[model samples]
Target: MKEMTGLVNTKNKNKLPGDGVVGKTCNNVCNNKTFIYTRKSALTLLKTAGILLLVLVLLAAFTACVSRSNQEVGDTGTGTGTESSSGTGRETGGDQGDVQGAGSKDAGEFPLTVTDANGVEVKIEKKPQKIVSLTLSTDEMLLSLVDKGRIAAVSYLSVDPGQSNVAEEVKDLQKTGLEVESLIAMQPDLIIVADWSDQNAIKQLRDAKITVYALKTPSSINQVKDAVMTVAQLVGEKGKGQEIIQWMDGKLKAVEEKVKTLEDNQKLRVLSYNNFFCTHGIGTTFDDITKHAGVINLAAEQGMVMWQEISKEKIVELNPDAIFLPAWSYEGFDAEEFAGSLKNDKSLAGINAIKNNRVFCLPEAHLGTTSQNIVLGVEDMARAVYPGLFE
Candidate 1:
């Protein structure tokens, strides 16, 4: 889940103290009070959790991003049964199209043909067989594309039932810990990392010449679809990837249709806050989803995508029509904590959403990963953004 930090509007200097309103329950593994002892220090880069999912999946955290040029092969397979892997489309359809028959990319099934993101050429002898997934989402994505026999080791965190999809598969692996040596020993073919921030781990694996695919964070839905397809191809599970994309697309359309039916005047002005009371602003996936939901994002209005620390005073100034505080308090707090903070704050009474009781809760599961489940979150968002319309 996205872990949030308390913010103080370091970006928007115009906002002052006694701002409009809110305090989120502390998502720190430790319980922190209103004025907890805070130590200010630069955060050294650690491994990227879900890359974007780890940060923005909830309210408290913000996602960090950088770029990369990965090897790529052409998006071939002319939808012909004669192709090496064909009919990888879903029968029910997805946001992209076709889902069924997208698995069975077993080890050594196909020769490894590495394609750089910039369309550069790199050739390899064999496709990745034993893969290690970095985050919960990547592991889930891998599971969807291939079988458990293929995965060498998944992230240790994947055992956190709240965050992981294949809880059963990862349950035993967690006890072992996700150590580097353990991964190297499992050594079969390749290791896939979620974010480039994992360069240290990737470098260690690369020294052994294990094919490491560094996946860049995706901002838009299409990027998600493309990423899945790329990973699928790499694993020789393009069919499985197609199925996943199809599911996502189907959900997107359902969400869009629901959004279109809302009253024209009911365009919700929304804000997404996490357990840390920090808001998700612009350039984040949650913000993109809010936009896609046909609701106006209060954070976007203030130019906050990836959590800009702002005071309650600033929120009052924005005075959004509605507030959407996702419950990413993986630290054991309730989902309603942030919304309650907004509703109960005396100073926040001046804000429009509070006065109107327009704050609503979003489902944690939908908001968290949604690799095979983006549609579920979108549907929940549509319902939350417009309550009565869904029924």
Candidate 2:
């Protein structure tokens, strides 16, 4: 049997503040000036007023009670989830996703609630066994945390060794496109997509009740660690997540110690170059790596807060201390040819990196990564900036 509660109308229609029984009674009492108020008449009037006051107080209390009850449990007919005082979902357990530090709860517990990068709270009734990765970063993070069997598919980018750190392991998994229909066909229990993925596809996937983790691009080492840890918690691999973070921290601390002895002026001014003259600016993973590696990003120095292409004239003017070419190892790309072109460009002839032959082509796997391997990118950069210190 379903239980039901109806709203109580507590307004007292019979009693008003002015112009009624009280008015008539007062008029009659005052009209007879010779009739002085005996104790009996005065007590009768007091009793009448006291009864009206009691009715008003009772109505006010009842109204307040009803409002508070409604606020606590929103429209009960609808199945909308409730939020606690902290804004975390009022599920059996506190928000599993927002949990920090090493988790103590059994991750295998059913009906888990997690807050994704999009700030949407997702509830998983059971552990996700079949996962699909829609981005290269998530592909690498997943492979590092879960078993190969758990990963049903990975993005097409993950199949290319030039663009993915886990390409070797994910080469056998089926590759997926960034289409809603394609994702639906996979019937994934969980899907990990980037924050910038197609909104239409994300909406369609969510409409189909597919659990999607819209992971964001990390701007710093701490954010990278947090991303990895968040995924680990989602995939029931918190231990593996902690291990990866610890490893990254060890590598980063080594670089920090090496750069600790260097003076501020001694830090190298560097620029990251793709095939085109484009580079990442402030609030980017590459920019953060440059900071950790004890080098200044020339693009950031120019007040570029996002990825932008610079004119050849500007490149010559900046004359970076070292030039990092991250795309030199892409399948058919010829590193030597690119280097020759940089050296021969008349506009870039006066650049310090070209003059000193310090243009370095870093391995694409680590250099372009925003995942845990970013620590490797930081280490490689630090080595290039201060060659003898790393050796």
* Best-matching candidate per TM-score: 2
lDDT by residue for model 1 (1-391), tens: 1111111122321111111112222232112110001111223456556667656553232222211111111112211111221123322222222221212223124554443332222233455657777766566677666656667777765665545545665554433233567667877476656553445766677677666665545555655665676577667765556666666676678668878866657788877666666877777767777766778877877766687777788778888877766654455675545556657889989777777766655444345563544445556666655666666
Clashes of 1: 36
Error of 1 at 113 (Å): 3.2
Enumerate clash totals for all models, in the order shown: 36, 0
After superposition on all CA atoms, how large is the RMSD of candidate 2?
25.9
TM-score of each: 0.66, 0.71
Candidate 1 ranges beyond 4 A from true positions: 1-109, 115-124, 172-178, 331-339
